[model samples]
Target: MALVPMETALQRLLEDVGPLDGESVPLKDAYDRVLAESIVALRTQPPFDASAMDGYAMQGADAQTTDGELAVIGEVAAGSTFSGSVEAGQCVRIFTGAPLPAGTDTVVIQENVDRPADGVIRLREPTAAGRNVRRAGLDFTTGDLLVEKGHLMRASALSLAASANHARLKVVKRPLVAIIATGDELCLPGSELGPGQIISSNSYGIAAAARAVGADVLDLGIAPDREDAISALVKQAVAAGADVIVTSGGASVGDHDLVHKVLTREGMTLDFWRIAMRPGKPLMFGRMDNIRCLGLPGNPVASLVCSQLFLKPLLARLGGRTFHQDIRTATLGAPVSANDHRQDYVRAAIEERDGQLIATPFGVQDSSMLRTMAASGGLVIRAPFQPASEIGDPCQLMMIG
Candidate 1:
């Protein structure tokens, strides 16, 4: 019976929630997945001291002078090793990635050496000891931690894991969200509209929002306003192993609102219903066993706004990621009259003037108008029972675009 505060509802929705179970996937398919466990290097990088450039490997002391000369003993290319050791006055032609000869401590680049004869080479410039040489385990050694748990596997992380000899990775399982739209007057998009009927668009937007937060979505399509039809889909969502079930419409107290009755019968314990926010006051949240159920309003704008405000964060938490709202401070560009019992989230057009953000709310903010919601850059928050405000007053803003 009472409207729940926005903050309290969010806290309840996320209470005790955490990352899902881990699943092993191939390295190629692990991109963008969160690591479930830390990755340790199995083998050392540059297992042996190797050459970093095409050069001649010899003792550093032997090539200290510009006139230094040494007899070419052997040639070592990448993926090949020199059997003989380098002795004084002797050098080996070594290509990039070739292991350093046993007795060599440095590599004189080819540009700094001139071939005086078929086997004799003269040094034009001296190279430092260990120059142009990659020491063993230069990048990482065995047992080194390559990546930590909960890290997102980006391109760089994937490459690092591969270099650490990891063929597969343990990643967090993406949370699955099952969506059901309930209404007698709702039809899928591109369908011929009957009298008093409208196209079903909330599920599409809700599904997209769910996916943007690392959730896998299963759209169960529209269910007519009947207890059996709604309950059947709810069972399907549970059978499909959905972590969360989202229902649009049938949440209010109207005669046709049957979601509450069916969900309670299906073992969902109502946590809270009705938020102290405009456009989305009819929001509902509950739980059945391990599955979370969120009943959103029927209006398109309300559905989208509630998704951005609540659903994204809940899904992100379940997927082993953190989500933060982009809230900022701005000045109201136009005067606004405000005084109400419910908090208002007035969608506004944002612009930057003289390095300050200016938020101008659209003239009409009907919950059914989707075009205005799409054109808004952010929402200007107004507290309940607040006084009328003039232009240039300070306001809190939540950026949506």
Candidate 2:
């Protein structure tokens, strides 16, 4: 079979995938969720003209001249309304947020006024109309669109939604991913390793990647190199309503590789296998009914690289979120050899020096070297069939972390 190119594999993996159905959630629980529908204001903000400062409300005409003395007819605070109207030489002492008096069009701040006698105040400075007053509907009017659909809710968005009188919000449902690790030579972390047994570490990184794209994860634990064990876990994933099922290892043609056989027997229509990429050439993708399945390589670095390249984007689309690769151009800090038929993603350390990005690839790029992959700052992309290059050559880099 011809190896699928990376771009073609990604396109097929994300084909026709869309956000899940909407569900209502309380305002406090809506943070970081994608809005399913646009939020419209139910009531206008500052429904009535109100004071913006602690001051005296009076007719604008009466405060146009300096040394203007006006009798305090009454007082009003926040949530309180003045009963009588204000006339010339008459004012109402008002606090912030109090409704403007019926006949008053301006407020002289307390700092700019003087209380010379009881029930009487003098304007120390001339004031203009509408000063220190918030007009009706100043922030937003009723029926105004405040937040559009597909927007990710943040702190400001939640506050705006609350101010728009929305106690609950319709948000896209988070995608659920089920992860399974396969192999008889694998054991959980912190366990005494028997002969030929290594700790299973890919699930942790894969789960974190899924969550970074807003997908929930269910770790199905380790499955021995047996068809029955693997098949049982696959069935459990389906019964758990997983939107995507991710399996680590057992994707190649080796004797112990049973993921491919089990998935096909379970009625998964194989989409593609063996991508034209280094380190992760044995990658596989398929679908079973409504659930998508991905078979990743056993090597730790290969699994993580494939997850960042493919799984993240697929989950982002299914969760109604946007994802973009942080690709950058950089100069190679060391010489590199020519590429083969497979595209290469060489792990490297990247630094910014003298206004230019310098990428230095590690000496050994073994896919099983998890420490090197963890320390890598980025991946230097090498196109297939490319010629050999030397230091200072321009290259494309995909930033990690």
TM-score of each: 0.96, 0.97
List clash counts for every candidate, in order: 0, 0
Estimate, for each residue in 280-391, the C-alpha lDDT of model 1 and write its tens digit: 9999999999999999999999999999988999999999987999999999998889758888899999999999999999989999999989899999998889998889
Candidate with maximal TM-score: 2
| Candidate 2 whole-model C-alpha lDDT, 0 to 1 | 0.94
Q: Enumerate residue pairs that collide in model 1.
A: none
Q: What are the per-model C-alpha RMSD values against the true structure?
A: 1.4, 1.2
- Per-residue lDDT over 135-198 for candidate 2, one digit per residue giving the tens place of the 0 to 100 score: 9999999999999999999999999999989999999999999999999999999999999999
Error of 2 at 84 (Å): 2.6
Please, what is the whole-model Cα lDDT of each candidate in the order they appear? 0.94, 0.94
For model 1, state the Cα shift of residue 233 in Å: 1.0
